[model samples]
Target: MPKPEPTELSRPYWDALREGHLVFQRCSCGNAWLPARRHCPHCLKPEPRWERSSGKATLVSWVVYHTAYHPAFESRLPYNVALVQLAEGPRLLTNIVDANEALVADAPVELQIEWEGDTALARFRLAHVTV
Candidate 1:
């Protein structure tokens, strides 16, 4: 597997994930996103603050790939890549930790930190909330 090479701007995000927290950049204009950019993806402002997520999100969409786009992923073929919108408004591309057939639009999900070698990755699973 190809490990993430954290750049200066993205280092904090990766470091936080390593410490078991999921965070995003929140601009003054209220836009938030992942994969750390220098400017707000919505308003084009600089140096947004990082905010820890509540670890809740909603399933937006997904696709199950039968073929590995990279040789490192050949063993995990048929995995689903998903789009999830966080409770705080930003959306990210991630994988759901459940059966591909169980996915549905708008399903509530919660964060589940997973590891790829030494790198921490943020994946999700159906929320198991208790009343």
Candidate 2:
């Protein structure tokens, strides 16, 4: 598996995931985001505060990759890559841990951290669904 190369700015995000907490950067302008940056993208402010998530999210959209885009992912072919929006307002690309057939539009999801070597990945699973 290709591992994440955490930059100085993103180290804290990785560390928090490792410690079992999912966090996001919130600026004074009230914008929160992920894959951290030195300045807030909204107000261009420096040093936004970090806040822990409630581990709650909403499934926005997703697609199943029947073909591997990278060699390392061949074993995991036909996986669903989803766009999920956190309750606090940040959206991230992640995987949904549920049967592809069970996925539904706007389903509620909760955090599910998975480990890759020493890196903790922030994935999610369905909270409940009917369809």
What are the TM-scores, per candidate, against the unseen true structure? 0.94, 0.95
The residue ranges of model 1 lying beyond 4 angstroms of the native Cα positions read 129-131
lDDT score, residue 16, model 1?
92
Go through the candidates in order and give each one's C-alpha lDDT.
0.93, 0.92
Worst 10 residues of 2 by lDDT: 122-131
**Which candidate leads in TM-score?**
2
Runs of candidate 2 with Cα error greater than 4 angstroms are: 129-131
lDDT (10s digit) by residue, model 1, range 1-131 = 98878999999989999999899999998888987899988889898999999999999999999999899989998899999999998899999999999999999999999998789999999997687
How many backbone clashes are present in model 2? 0
Per-residue error at 59 for model 1, in Å? Answer: 0.5
Clashing pairs in 1: none
